[model samples]
Target: MKLGKSVNFTTILLLMFNMLLTSCGKNDDGSGPSPIPEPGDGVVYLPVVVHVVHNGEGLGEGPNLSEQQILRQIEILNEDYRRKLGTRGFNDHPDGGDAQIEFVLAKKTPDGEQTNGINRIDASQENVPDLGYNQNHYAQYAYWNPEAYINIWTTPLPESSMCLALGNATGPKTDLPGTEHLSIPGPNDADGIMINWIHFGESNIDCHARFGRTLTHEMGHFLGLLHTWGSGDCETNDYCDDTPPVDEHVYGNVPFVGCAGEEVMIGNYMNYSHDEVMNIFTNDQIQRMHYVLKHHPGRNALLTSPAL
Candidate 1:
């Protein structure tokens, strides 16, 4: 894992300092991750519900993405999680491993009614052009019980014309080992994923989201994984031994010399690499996500949910 380059002490300090604002919690109040369970043989399925908030756009136009686009996004998620061959997710890297998890649109609503799990909300009629600066506004519009379903909200995060917003997710309440968890505690009812309308699903939007990696990347955050270089330090640890620690993010370059002299894992899904280059999740990262499901806040509740 040694890198083929020497380190510059002063440059490293700046990188570490810059990462302070982006550091998330390992726990809401600071706690270590539980001992990882032995990798299991079965698959883990979690029910998902998407809340698409558009600016009065008709279905399949603008922010109102077509049903097929949404489904394709889910399929892409499966490809990455299962490490399906013949797809972008498959990789022969020694550290790579299948997450053994899957996401499915919720089959039943919390009230016991049949559902496709897609909730469409027209924001213009309500006079709210975007959720841009109004964080959690979507929660007021529509929210499902976090215990039963993982809610995904998509809206125009852009305020006036220019739009570069991506997506974000909530981490578990309990911190994982070496975790500097989300700054905001609580796996609140508003828990789950929030994505921009333009870049969601199909990635056909005119942005860097040429692929649906934003969801997969944020999903890693939602589970408990950290950036490849935790908090942007060479001495930092993402708790995944396979993902070497570096001082800064690597885009498409492989074998970048890291802060600790190990080869940085530029291709890990948790890194901010280009969508086309990011793919595998290390064996350790998989274990960390699995740990969150069984031990972090309401994550365990999803295991027993009857939504599916």
Candidate 2:
């Protein structure tokens, strides 16, 4: 479905506004060179497919988000994945962190077709309500060759649905590392990542006053970023040193003095608050993600011999 020019313009405005609200001005506190280790041979780009389920209830019947909004979300993810633009409350260099990993929207498919690496699917109530469509229903569309793409699904629902929707504001379940693998949450975490409207869209969690930062946070999860504050305990860590150690997830109002006495990188996109703060990924996190790409089943071929 095509959107009118006017609708497109409005979507852009909303996206920019939300970004401004969530983005932080650049700060050199963590200034340093990119720490991402060089790839082995070929350049690997992560291709992502976005699936927006309509629920077939039509607008307003469920979550009233539109296609324009969904597209805006994709655009936002691309920008964040490419460049680190800091804002008032966010910083790319909390302790002066630098990263080298980059993401380019795939220009060609494994078969060599022009592609931006994004897909959309509209599902009817062919399945149950909470059950919705099987993950495989949409997975098929994104499975064009898993060695080359990352798939993301977004949907709208009541407040309760948002809570049960897996990776909401709570972040990924870490205590049960294998738990994420056992039941596999929504369905087949190995296949793709699923995000909910209240948590997935370009909008931020109202409780957190964050705008559009959740995707940044979640995409970190997709790219193998753990919570900055570490898993469930203060001792356990996300492995990034630039980020100060904190006890747990920060949602809604940020603490004035917590964060284990370390200067809070509240504006980093990884932080909980959506305010114009926390924009940068630390050099350490960059290394971790780069390391993760080394093993992610979908990323192997891209690193060795890619279509590019």
Candidate 3:
């Protein structure tokens, strides 16, 4: 089930080339795929279990990410959540914020066995499609208790070319106050993220989204945040006052003025901006996430899970 060294990279190149044709079109924004959240202890610590679904390539190569790669990716997640001052996640924007949440690699399995926090799946041997449109193909392998951990499955997907499914989450039915009626579609049933393997960790993948920000972006969705322009155009709001209502999802790091005539938060992770330019999560967004993490039954469970 192992892929040759060139196959994965070459495929990634093909995907990037496809982006050029699709760039003119707006991203089909809004996320579902419900990866819930956690709370309490002043600084919430949620355990994470990353499942690397590969074609059976060696560790750290292809999709079988090595321990070091996985570790670094988790670090990126933390840096963004904590808004660490010296890292890419840091920002001085008046609206910027730290979610005050941290992702702890699961030190134990659902069955209570010690683990290094990564699960490797050989797609070929496991009877799972390596590349496909249906995300449920890997659901059968999801952790027994998904809400207890941030279950992230990383692998390439055919839908990547559509500028749609590079990274997705199982998001909760957000109950953040003032927007109690506003729901996050329906990844409501399951929890966790399914991201394109190439963008899950640090890599020289020859693309604008190689810095692992896709996961951070999707994680925002997982914790119940919405796109800055939920339905694109001036049609809807993301429920975060700090984020202006933009016309559509922003792609590159270009300047943009929203429907309200305010400069858009292009650096905000919730938008579809490129990885190199994305950073802030904003004060309003942080509050929404904290509310969801504090009240959602499933999300609260993660905070108490023995896995942490």
Off by over 4 Å in 3: 1-41, 128-135, 156-165, 176-189, 233-236
TM-score-sorted candidate list, best first: 1, 3, 2
Report the lDDT tens digits of candidate 1 across residue range 142-215.
Answer: 78988889888886655333235777887775666656545343433367788876667655545456688888
Q: Estimate each model's TM-score.
A: 0.80, 0.62, 0.79
lDDT of 1 at 199: 64
Stretches > 4 Å off in candidate 2: 1-44, 57-68, 83-118, 128-144, 159-190, 198-210, 253-255, 302-308
lDDT, candidate 1, at 54: 82
Worst-scoring 10-residue span by lDDT in model 2 = 176-185
lDDT of 3 at 86: 94
Per-residue lDDT for 1-308 in model 3, tens only? 34566677778777778766665445455243323333433688888888888876787776777888888889999898898999988888888877789999888898899988888877767654533433365565555476678888886454344244577776776445334323343453445678887677777766788888988988887788888877554745777777877867677888687796788878989877887788898888888888888877777788877888
Model 2 Cα lDDT, one tens digit per residue, 31-137: 54333334433333555555555555565334545656656665555555444454232344444443433444455766777766544445554344343444454
Full-model lDDT for every candidate: 0.75, 0.52, 0.75
